[model samples]
Structures are given as C-alpha cells and as structure tokens.
Target: MSRSVSSHTSPVVRVDDLRVVFPTMDGDVHAVNGLSFEVPAGGALGIVGESGSGKSVTSLALMGLHRGSRARISGAIEVAGQNV
Candidate 1:
C-alpha cells in the first residue's frame, strides 16, 4: 500500500519491525530483522526468498505457530486493526 493512503481505509495486514531469532547453544541466528510492510484490504502481498532465508519463519510468526518454540519473535503483526 502507498504511504498516501488515508487512515480511514487502513491496511488489512500490517507488520512492523519484525524480527525472528533462534538462540542455539552455538549462537543466535537472526532470521529476520526490522521488516515492515502493509497490505490494504483486497490487496495482495508476496514474500520471496531463497532457501533458509526466513520466509517460512516469517510465515510461522504471522500464523501464530511459534508460541512454544525456542525462537524469539519481536514486533507487531496486525490484521484488521487487531494484533495477531
């Protein structure tokens, strides 16, 4: 969505400063950092990345599937003005 879009018709999906980290005994693996984007109602959003590039991790975060995982996720994900 464009930045000029007014607040009255806000985005249907929003992600801000999304970061996913896995703390292994070896070290911390940063999957994503400072990712932000928005998709307006009826709009489409695409995510593309190479293998092991955090695409699946990001999706897992969006779907609330990492609740019990050892990974640490920080940031905001909103759908229809509500946090996910």
Candidate 2:
C-alpha cells in the first residue's frame, strides 16, 4: 500500500523524481527509481521495506553519503529551501 502526505504544510525536506543507479560489471543496479516525498518541518516520516529494497541507499543519498563515481543520482532534494 502506498500513502502520500498532504501538501498542506510547509515541508522541511522535499524529494522529487529521485533515481539512484549504480553501474556494475554486468549491469546497472537500480537502487531507487522515481521516488518522491516530503516531510513537514515538525512532521516525521518513516520508511519501511524488505531487505535489499533500497531503503539504506535512499537514506545514504539523502545524507549525501554516496560517492558521485560509485552511484548515479538524478533528482531534486530540497531541505529548508535549499537544493541539496
């Protein structure tokens, strides 16, 4: 099931059309694809998924943990009105 938060409140964090891909020897590993979300300033968000479902990769991407050479990330991530 998928649920989305209402855009009534100002968001502290916003992500749009996020995609993270890693090129490997055999093929590309798609960690995240077309993911988008928003977290209000005082609101909390939780992410749940099975193993290897790209949860960690999403977090890493949000925290800017992934090296540019190791992963290809294309999307918009905004925090406090600043694009990250």
Top candidate (TM-score):
1
Local distance difference test, per candidate?
A: 0.91, 0.90
TM-score for each candidate, following the candidate numbering = 0.88, 0.86
RMSD of 1: 3.7
Per-residue lDDT of 17 in model 2: 95
For 14-80, candidate 2 gives per-residue lDDT tens digits of 9999999999999999999999998986679999999999999999989888975689999999989
Can you write out model 1's per-residue Cα lDDT over 1-67, one digit (the tens) per residue? 5545455688999999999999999999999888999998767888998999889999899999999
Q: RMSD to native for every prediction?
A: 3.7, 5.1
Model 2 regions lying over 4 Å from their true place? 1-9
Ten contiguous residues with the weakest lDDT in model 1: 1-10
Backbone collisions counted per model: 0, 0
* Local error of candidate 1 at residue 22 (angstroms): 0.5
